[model samples]
Each structure stands twice: as C-alpha cells, then as structure tokens.
Target: MAQPRKMLLVDDNDESRYQLQTLLEFAGEKVVTRTCEKTITNIEDNLFALVINANSLGDYSLETITEKYPHTPIILVDSNKNHPLIQQQHDWRVIGSLALPLKYPDMMALIRKCESFKPEDLPSQTINSGNTEVLFKKLVGKTPEITKVRENILQLTDSDVNVLITGESGSGKEMVAKNIHYLSKRSNNKFVAVNCGAIPSELLESELFGHEKGAFTGAMTKRLGRFEVAQGGTLFLDEIGDMPLPMQVKLLRVLEDRTYERVGSNTPIKADVRVIAATHCNLRKAILEGRFREDLYYRLNVFPIEIPPLRARKEDIPLIVQNLLQTLEARHKKKIRLSSTALKALNDYDWPGNIRELSNLLERLTVEFSNQLIDAAEISQKLKQQGRITPSRIPEARLPEGDFDLKELLSNLEANYIKLALEESDGTVSRAAQRLGLGRTTLVEKMRKYQIDRDDISETDS
Candidate 1:
C-alpha cells in the first residue's frame, strides 16, 4: 500500500474549493483546502506534495509559497494560460497551469511533471561539466541560434585568433568578449575593454597606445595604453568600426607588425595581447564609404562572430527571463514573475535594444512589480513607453494592417515570412530556406539585400 500524497487546494470561491477537494479525495489523494495565507504558512514542512491555487488566491502569495517550499509542486489554476497576469507567474516553474473543471489526466500529468522537476533543469542553473566552466549558461538559451554562439565561444578558446564580434548595441558583444578572455590561456593577465566610439578622436590614440609625460599639454604623467595594459592577455575593442580614419591606420600597423609606440615615444612596444573587436556598424559598408579602413577590416575580421538580436531569437527569452529573475530575486530578496502572456508579448515585439535593453527592462519590472504578477497589458504599456516593442511583427499572418505602397507591403510581407521561417527553424539558414522554398544561396542573397544579419537568420554558416 502506497502512502497518500498530501495536496493543498487554495480557492477563495467556496463552491470551487469544495469541488476540487472532493475531486482530489475521489481520486484517492489526501487533500486539504485553504483560503488564507496564515493557514498554509502554518502548515509544517514535508507535509504537502502539491499546492493548487484556483484563480487568484488573495494573500497567499504564489512566489512566497514556491520559494518557501521549493520541493512542493505549485499550480496556478486559470481559464487562460496565456492571460498576461497568469503568464507572469510561470517564472516560479509552476507544475503547469490547470484549466477550469480540470481533467483527471491533466492532474496526473502535473504530478508526473512535478516529480521530474530538477533545479538544474532551469537555465539559471550554474553547471559544472568537467573542468571547463559553462559561462554561457548565464547567457541562458537553448535554441540553435544561441547554442551556435556557445560552440563558437568554445572554439575561440583553443586558439589565439583575433576575433571580431559584430552585433547591435546592447546585444552583448563585450560580454561575449569578456567570456573569451576569462576562458583563454591569458585568463590570469589583464583583460582591458575600450570603447572606440566613446573616446574622442584626438585622445583615442593616447588611450590605445598610451602617452608619455610630455606627449601632450594634459599629459603630466606616463600612461600605459590599453594594449600595454593588456600585455600577454586580451584587448576588447568595442565599437571598433567607430575608430577614426587615422587611428585605423595605426591599428592596422599594430595588427600586421604586432607592435605599437606611445604618443611621444619612438621605441615600439611588442604587443603580445590578443585582439577581439566588436561593432554594430556594417564594417564592409563603412570600408567602402571610406569611414573605416579596409586593411584594418580584414585584419580584425579574421574570426567573425555576430550575436543574434533578442527579437530574432525569441526562443531565448524565457531562459533569459529565468536567469535574470534568479539574480534579481536573490539581490532584491523579492520574487518577480512574468506571465506567459507577458513573455509572449515580450517575445512577439521586436527588441531594438537587444539583451542590454531586455536586462534593463527586467530590472525595472523587478522593482516596479515586486512580488506582483505582471500581465501582458503592463508589458505592452511599458514596451510602448520605451519604444522598444514594434506592433508590426505581432500578427501571426505576415500581412500589414495599414499600408500605402504595394511594393513596400509585398517587401514587408516577404521579410516577415522569412523572419518567421528563420525563427521557426531556429535560425538555421538551410532549414529556413527549405521551408521558404528557396535555395540556400538565393536566401543568403535575399538576406543580404534585405540587410538581415546572418545571426538573425541563423548563426550557422549554412
């Protein structure tokens, strides 16, 4: 004879609560129904196997309940799982949502899913697979688009090849570069990151190659450039495409000659550090326009890695939300959850700001909606205010609602179709091409014409 599993059914609706309790009892499970927080809070540990909240359980916070009883399975019963408010609570890893007049088979499935739940199954989990640290876990994604990025990161470590990571602002170019430095043989040495665009053109040379005490009027003391500071390590040049034309010539010299001189010093310094550059601009286009050096472009583009935008890899949103929530919760000591509707809204909208924007939004939401469920409506409002989410991509069909030009409309429809295929196919160009009934080369050409990034299509070379 097996011992009966304890289940707590919470519902403010008396009739609904009684019905659920009776159903559980009829199903041969030991059941307890409670409507108040105090009642459930007082229940001893190792007592309940599951906690089911019907509709909204007033004060008995689901976040608190899940955290306090991590082992106990918590299910939020709702009419619609996609409800913005309901979807917000998925972060707690609820044992699936139960619909009204829930079926017995669904209950059994939840029980089985709960039993199989492991902490490591979450994207926020810190994993140790042999000696190599899984740094990309925090990057938090399982899609092939993101998985390919991880594969590239791993490959980057075995060699000291100069890497050029191209991605939109806030898409985590520097973070990826940081991971490369930490995972490299030069991990012990200094890892210096410089933003070429942020520094003025006049001071840019001094910043990269350093300056002697008498190099300039402001140079009262000897300064070590980023290259010298990063000796025997790695130097991350952010927004490298923004470097001035003259600086590009100097940079090209350093790359080819493996040496540089300080602003006032004639003696050249041997730069043993590895270079990893990143930019949001189209470097090839920049080269053609004479804004960026063509020679420097080839030197830095030796091993290119382009990060996919958040909208392009919407599959990564849930994992990213989970990972961000884990840290935000631990820091704030408050639980923040996103409803499935909210998640979908976030995933549906085009993220112009990428991961950095997503992270900032999560942080803001964490504080604003502390311990409260965030619905799709709130997410929509917030996204609108930030001008981060675009409504054009929301519809399942690729048709535009309000449009003037047939040519423009058709182009948008085609682009939307391609975007959907790439997303559905997990950014694999070949797979997306197959789905679109186009040759791989033809799709690649179209993507180029449309200015669709390779990462947005798929990180794979295919």
Candidate 2:
C-alpha cells in the first residue's frame, strides 16, 4: 500500500479547475487546486509529484516554474496540441500534453506513467567549474584510457570545432558527444542528436535541413530541422559514415558556409550550430572503397577522438557495474548485488557489445534475480546463452621458407601471443602479462609498439 501522490493542478478557469480537481480527488489523489497567480507563491513550500498546468499563467512564464523545480514532472493542458507554446516546449520535464477537457482514460494513463519518473533519469545541467570529471560523471570509469578521453573533452570545451568521434558500436560515442556539448560554451541551448544510419536517405536531407509545408508528397506542414532546432547549440551526427554521398556533399557545403536552405525554400538560413559527428566505421577505409568522400572526412575530423572499447578497460568493470546497479535500483526500486565471483566472471569475459551489452545484462539480471546475490555460475550460464563464451587457443608461430623478414615475423609472433594471453585473461594487463612471463609495463610497451588493442583483437575474433 502506497500513499496517494500529491498533485498540483494549476488552471486559471474556475470551472475547468474544479472539474479536474474533483476528478483527481475521486481517483484518490491528493489534489491541490490553485490559480495561475497563486500557484507560484505556494509552489516552494511543498514538493509535488506532478504539476498539471493549463498553459494560462498570465504574465508568468512556464520557464520560471521549470527552472525552479527542475526535477518535477509537468503535464501541459492546452486546447491546441500544435499551439506555439506546446510545439516549442523543449524542456524534458514535460512528460506529455493533453487537449483541454481531458478524457478520464487519458488522464489516468498519464498519471500511471508519471509514477515511473525517477529523478536520476533526468539529465543534469550543472557543470561545476568546468571539471571534466563532473561533466562526464556518467562515463563511469577510472582507467587511464577513459581518463584521457575526459581530458580530451575538457580540451574541446572552449572551442566549437567540429569533433569526429570514432569508436566501436556501444563504445559510448554519443555519450562523449553529449559531455562535450554540456561542457561547451553552448551548454544552455538544446543538444540535438540525429543518427545518419537510422534515417532513410531520401528523408535525411529534409530531416537535417528541414522542409517547407509543400516540399514533398508527405510534407504536410513546415517543420524545423535538426539544424534549426539546435541553433546556438550542438548537433550530434551519429554514424556519419553511413550518410549517403549526396548528403555528404551537402553537409560539407553547410560545414564550409554555415548556411543552408529548407528543401522547398530558397532563403538561406545561417546555422549557428556546432556539429559533432561520430562513426564506428573506418572513414579512411571507406574513402579508399569510394563509399565516403575524402573532403567530408577531413571537415568532420578536425579534432578526432577515438574511444577504446570496454574490453580495453576491463579494470573499470566493477565501477561500471556499481554505477549501473544504482540506476537499476532507482528505476526498479529493488536492490541487487553481485557476488565477488560473479563480478570476476564478468571481468573475465569479453564484452563484444561494450557498455550497452553490460547494461542490458544488468537489467536482465535485475528482472530474473532481484534482491539476490548473483553468483559466478549464473553469470556463466547467461553468457553461454548469449553465445559469448568461447575457448581460447594458443597461436603457433610458423616459419616461412621464402623471402620473409625475420624481425617482422618475430614481432607478429609476439603480438599474437600477447593477444592470446589477453583473451585468456579477459584483458587484465597484469594477468595477461603474468601469463606471458612479462612485466606489466613491458607488456603495455609491446602492445603499444605493435599497435595492438582490445578492439583489434575483438575484430580478429569476430
């Protein structure tokens, strides 16, 4: 049995407010009715589970309410769904809007949905003193590799240069882009993200630059594009390598001129947006294969940052697990713990899907083993079910009879053995080094010299 949620219903119209208040009270909710003029004065004294606003706060901007209670969820009541205020509402706190004279079913459904709104799900706007650690609090790692990434993000905070982030899928490229955006000079504006690979090629241009009301067959109304929406902020172009060649040319032009026009309009609009592009593909290789343009690559790759996959930073697994479990507990309202052996099993397996895979596994565990200690055997069973477990085999060095470089052969053999040891030890440098009879620092040096990384080995295995 849970207590009734306290809801503040703000409506200027006396009849409408009374009707809504009576309905809410009938449903056993604690309803506090207030006119727009009096709501602000009383909003500070008590915490509210939800604020139902009729968008009729004369002279009082909703921005003030949102700014004051950033974590509180809001439900907008408007006669028109396409009203400029409702359409332009960019605050993430507003869960949904309803037409005036709301139906009982819709209102009840929305109330049910609001019950799941956890404060941790909201994105934080505060960046304390431009600290990279604070800006990247969600990054969840202490490894040197991730530390370098934070440092790179810190360096880019002051500049609006086009950043190209390259990494494997689920390596948190979008997360990196977001950290850069929140830490940059444009932190106060919207951070728009568009996936180049997800959108159809035909609609991608209009999606990026917007379209006129009659631009195409399905263009029923004029819509703001990602560029217009992200004005004075950052536009994150994820998986840019998958953008078509024609769109690439257009994007390059926009990058060069900082201007673009809607699909069916000739008026040029100045783009004051910063662009951050990310891709998992090798753009250089794509260029060689004629799948990508060389000039476009250079335009977006002005300040390149590559994120190492999760396997490369296995030492961060425990911290990541802890961070993820906190989020799970907040969302599910249930606590779950992993035994030391279970944690060790996770660190011993290669996370091919990286952080996203780890997060999914944690969620699954919460569903199946809530409020319980998960052990190594259970973790192994799940990994086996996912077909992620495979036996490691040692590589044998072969001598070539023809004209082969002895130095290159020995280097190849050493790299192979290192890769094998890393696979067997699940990428713990200390464990892998011990298995290879080499010091940790020595193993690291060899890995650097050979340009061998966990991502490289993961690619080989795949």
Candidate 3:
C-alpha cells in the first residue's frame, strides 16, 4: 500500500499545535509535531508534503525551510498580514495564510487540499520532446528569435520555478505559460488562471483566497479561493502588473509564508500551490514610479519570459493565420479558404494587437464570408467599412496652382492607406492585407518598400 502523507507542524503554542494535530490526524494524515526550536533533521530525509508554522518558527524564517527543501511545499501562518519578512519570502508557492487562532472548516479544507495534492492535479499540460516539436510546428515560422523562445521553454523543463511572462496584450503570454507548465514537472496539476486586472480590488482577495459564509455583507455562502482550489496546481496570475498595491502586499505575504486567511476567517490555512504570473506592462518602470512593489517584482522575476510581438516575428504570420483559420473553421463549421490575393494581403500588414486580433478576425471572416474563398477586394471593402483604415485626405498644402503632386500625393495616399489598413486590421499585417487590395507577401514587400515602422505608432499609442 502507498504510504500516508506526512506533515510537519511547528508552533510555539500548545493549544494551536494540539488543535492542528487532532485535525490532521482526523484527516488520515500522519502528523509530526515540533516546537519552533526542535530539530527538523528527521524531516530532511523523509517525503514530508508540507511544513506549517508561523513566520518565527522557533528560530527560523519560512525562507530557511524553503531553501533547505526546495521541492517540499511550506505554508506559513502569520497574524500580521503586512510583515516584511513574510513579504520577502512570498515568491515561492504559498497555498494559504491565516491569522492567530483558527477556524475548523477552512483549516480542514486546506488540509484536504494538501492531502489530495499531486503534481498532476495542476492545470498545466505535458510537452515532451515530440510535443515540443509539435508546438514549434503549431507556433509556425523558423525565426532565430522564436527558436530562442522554444529553447528557453526546453531549459525550464527540469526546474519548478516561478515565471513572469511579458508581452503585448494579444501576444500569447498565457499560451506560453501553459506550454511551460505542460513542459515542466507540474504538468498533472490544475492550471487556474486569474486576470488581476479584471477582478476589482475589493473582490480580488476573495476571488483568490475565497471567503467564508457571511465573510462580508454580500458574501452569503462559503467559497473556495483560487489558491485553495488550485492546490497542487498552477495558479496563473494574468495581468499581474495591474494588481492593486494592497493586494500585492497580501500576495507577497502568501508567497513568503505559504499560508493565507480567508476573507472573514482568522484561522491559518495552508495550501500547496504553484504560481505563474504574466503581464504586458513594464514592472521595472512601475516599481520606479511607485506603481509596482520592488520586492514583489524580484519574486515574480525569478524566471522571466518575454513574448515577442507579431511584427517582430512576421515570418510566423502565415502559419498563425493557417492555424487560426483552421480553428475558426472548426468552431464555425465552415470550410472557408483564403484566396492567393487575400493571403498575400494578410502577409503584408503589420499586426499590432498580435495573435488575438488575428484570431478574432478569422472568426469574424468565417462567420460572415462562410465557405466562399475570400478575396482581397471583398476583404478590403469590409475593412474600410469597419473604419480599420482610412484613406489620406488630399493635403491642401503645397497644391501646385490647380493640381497637387500626384507622385507625392500617391505616396501620401499609400502611406495613409497602409496606416488605415493597419488600424482597421488592429495592426495585423495579414488582416490588413486582406482589407487592402494586396497579398500578404505583397503587403510585407510594400511595408519594406514604404520604409514604414509599425512599431513607431504602436509604441506612441500603447
């Protein structure tokens, strides 16, 4: 039979330790109790799943335990939510944090999470050598830049470290995170994703750590927090740069100690969760400007991964388009194909919104155009009507007598047209090409010929 999971509980308080011991034993776990000053050497060689205690566990900080046993999860309990020692240690996988005294249900639930914990319970996928090759194929293109990203993913396979993904809004940051999770040892765990920007600050804490019945005026029932739900899994903090300062502090504490209290409860709970955070914003700048926490930045930056924008890797546009088209067609139950002219148009425009815009456009096209092969003219007409790109109005300045410089005017017009095409298509070259009377390849050539820098405008606005 498989051996029962063992848990080490370190606390100076007799009542708290005894209470926890009873609870753990009731849950069918083998509990080992030790005072803060007690030697932890016995745990060093055993397969203890978790270590639970306050920040001052006898004489050591949770970081000491984390350093000694990197793979074994540790949950820290602290009454002071804003403790600095706890904040600095927040980078690791902390499942929960609780205050003094304890609530039974929440604590028991946390223990259940730990007992049920398995690497496969997380939401990450598995990417083997063959899967990596498949992903490369699906991702498209063979640019040295893209090759480097793939290489980084490969390198991360052996380590279970926190990762911070940065990229433009639609540049597939989450996809990269999923690929990393699947490629790593945590592939079997659940992958719980959270949009830090989407949840209101007031709700963020509850959303992340959950709330007990009547925790707040509006909270009528018990709810499991993302951290608890994502136990033995990956918690993806999307748009992490947008998290509020207060929330950051709370989050920092959780990372430092591996424990958290629910919205209304004071009982300390422990969780065995992994975290993966992503954002398009420049966190360094945020830290300098007092927008993001410096300590938190360091914590999340342990494994930084930057996803290049679509324009930077234009070679992948065709492949991305192919993949997007297939996906859309499957979803919509259509067999639409892009004409050579349409395909060429798609290849030429600059994609500013990245993959997301491309995917959205494909969905729209499949829905509106159906099975008929889409042509450049029809595509261009549709884009113009949508106001994605507008033609440049004739400039009254330097009008020669009754006429204007046709060559100069045409150049201006072309520039305006490409700009309009870019905007109409949400900065996607392929979509812009389809919207313009050009092929994707032709659009690329024209962009090069026109000496246009798509990023200039993108940077100015974004």
Candidate 4:
C-alpha cells in the first residue's frame, strides 16, 4: 500500500500540538510532532509534504528548512491573531499562514492543497527556464524577446512571488499573467482581475477589501472583496500605475503583512493570493512627480517583466493573425483566406493598437464581408482609415513613429472627435453629444478624461 503523506508539526504548546497531530492522523496523515526547536534535527533526513509551525515553537532557522526541503510547503499558525511578524511569512519563504486555535476544516483544507503539489508538476524555478513549450505556444511568437517572456512565465509557475508586468495597453500583459496562473500550483483556485484605473478612488478600497453589511450607505449586504475572493489563487491588478496614492499605502501594508480587514471590520483576514500587476503608464515618472509611492514601487517590482510592443516585434504578426483568423473562421462557419498581398499590407502597417486592434479588425471583416477572400485593396483601405493615416478631411496624417499608448490613443481620439463634432454643431454640447452617439454625461466624462477645455474648441471654430 502507498504510505500516507507525512507532515511535520512544530510547537511548544503540548495541547495545541496534540490537537493538530490527532487531526492529521485522523485524516490518514503521518504526523510528526516536535516540542522543541532543537528536536527538528532529528527529522533532518525525513521527507515531509508540509511543515506547520506554531509561534510557541520559538525561533527556528526558516532558511535552513526552506533550502533543505525546497519542495515542502511551510504553513504558519498564528497564536496571536494580530501579530505583525506573521505578515512576513511569504518573505520568510512560508507558503501559508493560519489563525491560532486551528480548526480542522481550515487546517485540513490547506494541508490537502499542499499534498497535491508534485515535484514533477512544475520544473525547478532555476532549471529549464525556457523549455515550457506548452505554455510558450500560447503566445504567438518565436523572437528572442518573446522567448525570454515565456521563460519568465515558466519560472513563475512554481511559486507565488509577486510579479510586475509592464507594457503598453493591449500588449497582452494580463494574458501572460493568466497563463502563469492557470499553469501554476494554484491552478485549481481562482484568478481575479481588477482594473485599478477604472474604479473611482473613493470606492476602490471597498471594492478590494470588501465591507460588512451596513458598513456604508447602500452597503445592505456583506461582500467578499477581490482579495478574499482570490484567496489561495491569483489577483491581477491591471493598470496598477493609475491606482490612487492613498490606496497604494494600504496595498503596500497588506502586501507586507499578507492580511487585510473588511472595510468596516477590524478582524484580519489572510491575503494569501498571489499578486501580478501591470501598467502602461511610466511609473518612474509618476514616482518622480510624487504621485506613486517609491517604496510601494520597489515592493511590487520584485520580478519585473516588460512586454514588447507589437511594432517592435512585427515578425510575430503573421502567426497572431493566423490564429485569430482560425477563430473567426470557426465562429462564422465560413472559409476565410487572406491573399498574400493582403497579408503583406497588414505586415507593413504599424499596429499602434497592438494585438487587440488586430483581432478586432479581423472580427469586423469576418462579420462585414463574410467568406469573401480579403485582398490588398480592402486591407489598405481599412488600415489607413483606422491608423488615422488618411481621413476624408485630412489627406495624410502621420502618427508619431512607434508611439501609441492605448489609453492615450483612445482619449485623444475621443477628445478630437468631440472637438470636431462641437465645431460642426457650432459649439453645442447637446448637438455634439448627439452627433457622437454618446449620452451627455458620458461625453462629459470623456471630455474630462482628455482634459479638453471648452473654450479652446469654440474659439478655434469662431
């Protein structure tokens, strides 16, 4: 018969240790209890699936245990629920932390999670960093830059180290984050994504940390925040650079302590989710202007991965388009082929909108033209129109070479269109909103996003 999984429990509290040992044994686990830190040496050669440490065990060499037993997961038991040091378990290489007075449900659940980790399931973090063809193929590219990114993603699957992914908007930063999470040890759990920039600053905290019922006006029901919802999983913070300054402080604290409370409650909950942050904004610039916290920047910059813009890696365009074409074909139930000349035209144009724009254009073509073969003439027409290279009023407009941030592009386009519509309407907001097909409130918000001065457009028109 296969031997039962073994767990090493360390605690000086006799009753506490006995309780945990009995629970593990009942669940078919080989539980080894060490009453003194000195006795840890006795099991130096033993192989354990997990190590549970209670604060009563006193100071022991965490590095020694982590290094010697690299595959074994270490979980901490917090006797004092509010103890500050418990927050730094991740930094100390502990994979998880449990509240004091262990409940069998919570303890067993965590141990069972750890027991599922097989050494062969993940390659060593330091070995074969680039050999992940399975995950690498998900991204369409063979360039060295993309290969390096694949290597980084492969390395991240084994541990819950914080990652900061930087790239222009729509450059697949979040997609890469998802690939890492889905292929990771925590794959069975959740993957929650939050757009830090979209939510208003006033409500961002409650959205992230959740709140108790009646915590505030209209908070009629208890809610689970993204952190809690993502527990034992991964949390992806998209557009992280736009997060308000105040929230940065709170985020850094939770990152440090691996814990947070509901908006209206003081009870600490373990923030066990792996964090992956992405941004198109230049954070260093934000830091210099005192907008982003320097300390928080460093904390989140543990392992940095910067994705190259689409223009920088144009060679990958063919493969990307091919994959996208297959999807379009299946969805439309039609055979669609791009003429060689049409493919060349696509390769020639600089894709400021990146992969997202490419996918959108293909979908639009499939819907509009159906199964008709796309040729160079149609490709050129649409490419120039969307690239903003040749509008009816403007004969030839050259976009700045290889420089277009998705947010900035959208904002600028909206602002310019609103200006044109206002000019055409003789500077009337109602008429302009009508022409732009936007509600007045949404138009106003877009105007504010672009910071367009009302007087400027009207003055030019007059």
List the global CA lDDT of all models. Answer: 0.72, 0.77, 0.69, 0.72
TM-score of candidate 1 relative to the true fold: 0.57
Descending-lDDT candidate ranking: 2, 1, 4, 3
Candidate No. with top lDDT: 2
Off by over 4 Å in 2: 1-118, 122-133, 388-462
Model 4 worst lDDT run, 10 consecutive residues: 120-129
lDDT of each residue in 1-462, candidate 3, tens digit only? 876557777777887788767866786778778775563554444544564656547567665665555545555666676865444332233445555565667666566555554421222112345423223323445677666677777778778777888888778777777767655566546778887865657789999999999988989899999999888878899888878899999999998888999999998789677788988778999899898999999888898888888888888777777766765654567857888898777666566567776665666788888888998887676544443433464345564678667998888878878876666443556556667878767887888888865554341111
- Which segments of candidate 4 are over 4 A away from where they belong? 1-133, 388-462
TM-score of 2: 0.61
Each candidate's number of clashing pairs is: 7, 0, 48, 0
Residue range 45-137, candidate 4, lDDT tens digits: 444554555566456555555555665767777777666445434321354667866787877777766765543222222223343224232
Could you give candidate 1's per-residue lDDT for residues 240-300 as a string of tens digits? 8768798898999999999999999999899999999988789889888888887788899
Task: Write the residue-wise lDDT of candidate 2 on 74-164 in tens digits.
Answer: 7788877787556543454666666777788777767766676666555432233332224354576778888888778878977999999
**lDDT minimum window of 10 residues, candidate 2:** 124-133
| lDDT accuracy of residue 117 in candidate 4 | 55
TM-score of each prediction = 0.57, 0.61, 0.57, 0.60
For candidate 3, give the lDDT of residue 363. 69
Those runs of model 3 whose alpha carbons end farther than 4 Å from true positions after fitting are: 1-138, 385-462
